[model samples]
Target: MKIFRMKNCLLGSAFLLLLLLQFSCKSTYELGRKRAHGISDNRLYNQIVDSSLSYKSLWVKRFSAHYESNGKSQNVKGSIKILKDSIIMVQINAPTGILEVARIYITPDSVKIIDRLKKEYLTSDFFFLSEKLNMNVDFYTLQSILTNSIFQLRDLYERQRPFIRNFKGKAIGDKYVFLSDKAAKVERKLRKDKYSRLYRFNYQRFEIDPSLMKITDVIVREFGEEREMVLKYRDFVKLEEQKFPSELVFKVKDSIQSLSCKLKYNKLEIDEDLKFPFKVSNKFKRIYPD
Candidate 1:
């Protein structure tokens, strides 16, 4: 009788422990969802847009880059700019004693890029340029780049909840072996199932500050690539009622590049009358260069 009672007690304890774990997991999942929903709310996106447009004028640190494709090497030099959306003009002096003048015009429908030195014009819709540059060419990147507030957590992830069904990590020397949901179907779709792509996807593994919600480190692994890219942020400062990063570093395999920008603010005004014309320039013939 005592043996049977002991067995029942052991089974009861095991059952209780399982129930507690299940409840804990459910609670964590709900909390994560709530946090994600809060971040995705339109209020956050609007706030970001509002803060971006508040600055009337700022100085942009322009870099003229020369890349040697075969050698995988790049050389960059600095220039200064006074930007007003109405007349987007920039003067860049390269190390080779070449002064290039460029002008940009942004509208709701199109963007125009003109090179005064080459007398070349490139015009396209925002989406085209964004894809060509492999960047988010929206107000977000522009605002962060201009203000040197590029490293905020809010800026990086936009407060979206990660859809991680199962994640495992193993300590490997100084680094960690990260494995998440490996199912291709689950990985290919966007967070909210808004967009789908063929690119191999994996959950980024890194530590972030809970309070600031800022990403401290990020790792991206493509399905076929043997290595991953890692980005680290440092040296933060407050600029124009916002916090931003002064330095950004990107590393992939054997190549590493660091960009350090100094934010300069000046008393300039924006021409709210700026409009985007739905037209393409002839010089961009090479873009669709026949």
Candidate 2:
């Protein structure tokens, strides 16, 4: 009962990636120091923007990942489906029989988790989740993480407007670095969410691979927090000439808790109409945050 009260439920809520931590601070910061041809920030930004993975939907046929926490390690496999800006569904499978360990459904507004191991379910909104995690989070932020794209702090995810362009960009040695308004040493109005009570757009930064022109890393820390959510994307594979990450890893921590994981996609498809199936069994009891 206590196990299901907190950790596992967060795992079902896209905390699945907190599964592994084969991460290094040196690798994330010290890369791409080689000099590339001189280009304007506008030209460089345009190239990065135009090169984004264009898609309406994405399907993860299967994925294998390793996650570690509290000095314990484990390997897991799962599947995910995304309806651009609409919905995301994830299923974590048991080691054998490949049975579902958990099923999660996420919409722009709310989150639903059905935990098989505990035979319990949780229904909550991002507002509650934000308050629980003590961070500024929304559906778009997770979507961007899963898809390996760039977004702005003020407007959230980038749509047709390319909110990232407003970020100052430059080739720092070998990698292109982008800073949020605050990171750029520029003053920008930050908004407060009525629900979470946390102000939006803390210190944010991005690192891009100059060769691929895709954002390879993202880091976000709230106004007063010490630990930050650091995400790194690598091992990109091209499908139809569009680049997508084959390996994704990240670590996020606040004051009392932390999570880290390494994920590798086995199969991927783009722009496919997909269905997300979710149903709680009668035997499954509904639970709430402690």
List ranges where model 1 is wrong by over 4 Å.
1-58, 61-72, 78-91, 96-98, 101-109, 135-213, 220-230, 240-242, 250-290
lDDT of 2 by residue, 167-260 (tens): 6666677787777544543233333333233344356788888777878888776644555778887766666567656667777787677767
Give a tens-digit lDDT track for model 1, residues 189-209: 645573334244434454332
Top candidate (TM-score): 2
Error of 2 at 185 (Å): 5.2
Assess every candidate by TM-score.
0.41, 0.78
In the predicted model 1, the residue pairs found to clash are 107-276, 149-244, 285-289, 286-289
